[model samples]
Target: MRNLLLSPFTLPPPSGQTRNCGVTEVLCEACDHLGWKKPTKIQIEAIPVALEGRDVIGLAETGSGKTGAFALPILQSLLASAQRLHSLILTPTRELAFQIAEQFEALGSSIGVKTAVIVGGIDTMSQALVLAKKPHVVIATPGRLIDHLENTKGFNLRALKFLVMDEADRILNMDFESEVDKILKVIPRERRTFLFSATMTKKVQKLQRAALQDPVKCAVSTKYATVDKLQQYYIFIPSKYKDCYLVSILNELAGNSFMVFCGTCNNAQRVALMLRNLGITAIPLHGQMSQNKRLGALNKFKSKSRSVLLATDVASRGLDIPHVDCVINFDIPTHSKDYIHRVGRTARAGRSGKSITFVTQYDVELFQRIEALIGKKLPAFPTQEEEVMMLVERVSEAQRFARIEMKESTEKRKRPKAGEEAADDGEQSSGVRKKVKGGSFRGRSKRGR
Candidate 1:
């Protein structure tokens, strides 16, 4: 039976069906212009309640259009009064903050709703300047917003009308509890609050109790679930020849866009470098990169200039990248919940996609935990041993090139250059596994039964 419970929603085909959520005519026209013909499931449930002036706790997975759920209502409220510095949206990461700001601008463009993003890696003085202008909406990371609240002259959220904590679980997971508390202390206690998260962990529950006032629970997915359209599979192989297998799969699946998740920032950079050397368009996005570079990488991948994006968990949550045909878990996540978020990058918005996880001998235990969490036994991904072995020579060559480039990049860390991977905080060096290559590529592999 289909899940009757609220779940990460699927977008319906663009039909003559209208998306009238009692939003103003201008907002309706804006939604139409943005091609949001019908709101996703989370939006359908959350928007109406929010329009009724109720606080909401939105439990929706990635790609469920939770942004629209909160955004449309906030804009509608702004329409009624047009209060300056009307809303404050706090996210765990800078990328998500910018994406929220982008949606706000799009949906509220006709009404001229100005938004400012406050996050680290960009100059604080610049962000302070933006705040001084008193934009109608401010989307920020907790840490950075805290910095401004404590340090910036004459900037505060005392009169903020709407407060949204997007990815509340992640924000608390990232140890921003104190920062969040500090923010809550400063904002008006009587304002409407929205807490949106994929999983309502205990920490999130505590936060909701503190932040919202008898909030309507607009839950889409409280379970650890993947989309029904996602085709899940795994490959069992020895750890040594992972690069060979990766190259083999990419060649076989040429023309499809991919997100290859690595365990560390350094590994993501190395994998992207290796893929580029072998004539694949790949880009790396991780925490070590500066804010500008991170956004640049995302834009390149989104614009389809890069066919594969090598990323750590930083790109996993709340980044709505389009046309991602597959997700390759190059390194299996130690935590099972992350596996859900990682693969959620693909098969979004009712589109069918595939996820192939590389289950090395060392990763079997971790991979098993993920299968158990998602409540399914994944079939093995099909692979030809001979085909993978044939890629050994070229893959080894690219590996050498990548290692040399990594060493050179490390030495040149003092000067940030165009196309240079920024120096990671010791985590990058740890991710590139050392292995003997060349004359022998010894590894066990299994094809799908």
Candidate 2:
């Protein structure tokens, strides 16, 4: 259990250490292209072990560069033995799977590496085609991968060289144990394996025994803690005034991007619409949305076209957005660990950030649990009650418009056109539509203005 809290300035040289770990020349060049000047703590610890063709269990927090810890070694090995579908990386969420695939592609771009992202809510035939061609690496979610493994013909990982379970704890928590068991039976036993997780739960420990052989443990942080650079605080208010408090905070901290986390998709959508009506550039990303829309929202936020992103826990883990200056826990997570993941979205890669959690009367116990888990007593985020009350009128009007927009969106979904409903087969339903329900256009209407 090494202390990973050392400042980057005082950290040992990563380039010299990575070279000593047998990292290939092409991989180093790729790191340079991606502007990776030095490896993070997780990478410094796990990469060498993985390069030796040994099973590794990486225990580190989110935004710790775990992808490169595994992807680099896998790509280095792939360079030695050119093969399609050489490796498989499993993740809990579709967004994480796509993000990992993007990293693989960026790292292996010079070597002409081909990677395919197989996740649910997308066309099966298109993924099947990609599988038939047999990309160099296959990054997927467990359920969708099992769907392909069982249903799609001529799609098996017979010669897979590496197996990676990224965010193993979340995968098991999402109830993908059966799918993982099925995958294990199909893939070869005599292969390298890597299990990376933020927290090592009992299920993860059990999974380690079932999945790995003589694994080396590389733990950077043995306890639950947030980054030192993160400034965490809470706002205490009545439950009815939560929205007003959020508006006050956003207005107070204007010009900085925010990731506002809600507890449900409906709430996330409502809040995004509410913010949009008040001239805030906010977007929503939830599990219920189509894959293309989810990616579109993420891209918009990443490209700075949107300043605030309202989302559920789906965006909490493994989807890195480096420009997030603040994380507002609009709805306090019931699980304390989730609070860590949500706030981890900001203060990434040595950059300082802020996290403000809203604590209502109903959320007292949850907030206490989060404090206990993180081993700190958070101070209150300063707010002027008068200033917050001043915005109540505008916020109430926006709430009314948001409710109308939500009702209309629900009606549209329920009353799809006759042909559209009939033609909604499995394949056609997965495609991205030009028009999205409850889109930003509704926020710019006359009433919203």
Task: Output the number of the lDDT-best candidate.
Answer: 2
**What is candidate 2's lDDT per residue for 1-449, written digit by digit as tens?**
11112211122224655453557665787898988888889898999888777999999998888999999988877766677789999999999999999999888876778899999999999999999988889999999999999999999999999999999999999999999999999999999999999999999999999989999999999998899899999988999989889988887898899999999998998888777767677888898787888888899999999898999999999888889999999999999999999999999878899999999999999999999999999999999999889777778877876777776666656887775531111112222211222322224333322
How well is each residue in 1-449 modelled by candidate 1, as lDDT tens digits? Answer: 11112121232322332357666666778888987877799988888888889999999878788899899889877766667789999999989999999999888776678899999999999999999999989999999999999999999989999999999999999999999999999999989999999888999999988888989998888688999999999999989899989988887888899999999998998887777666677789999888888888889889998788999999889988879999999999999999999999999888899999999889988988998999999999999998888888778877886787688677768675798565442223323323323322224222121
Q: After superposition, how far is residue 183 of candidate 1 from its true place, in Å?
A: 0.4
Which segments of candidate 1 are over 4 A away from where they belong? 1-19, 414-449
Badly placed stretches (over 4 Å) of model 2 are 1-20, 418-449
Q: In angstroms, what RMSD does candidate 2 have relative to the true structure?
A: 7.5
Q: Where does the lowest 10-residue lDDT sum fall in candidate 2?
A: 1-10
Could you tell me how far off, in angstroms, the CA of residue 240 lies in candidate 1 after the best superposition? 0.7
Candidate 1 achieves a global lDDT of: 0.84
lDDT of 1 at 89: 96
Candidate 2 achieves a global lDDT of 0.85
Work out how many backbone clashes candidate 2 has.
0
Return the number of clashes found in candidate 1: 2
In candidate 1, residue 54 scores what lDDT?
95
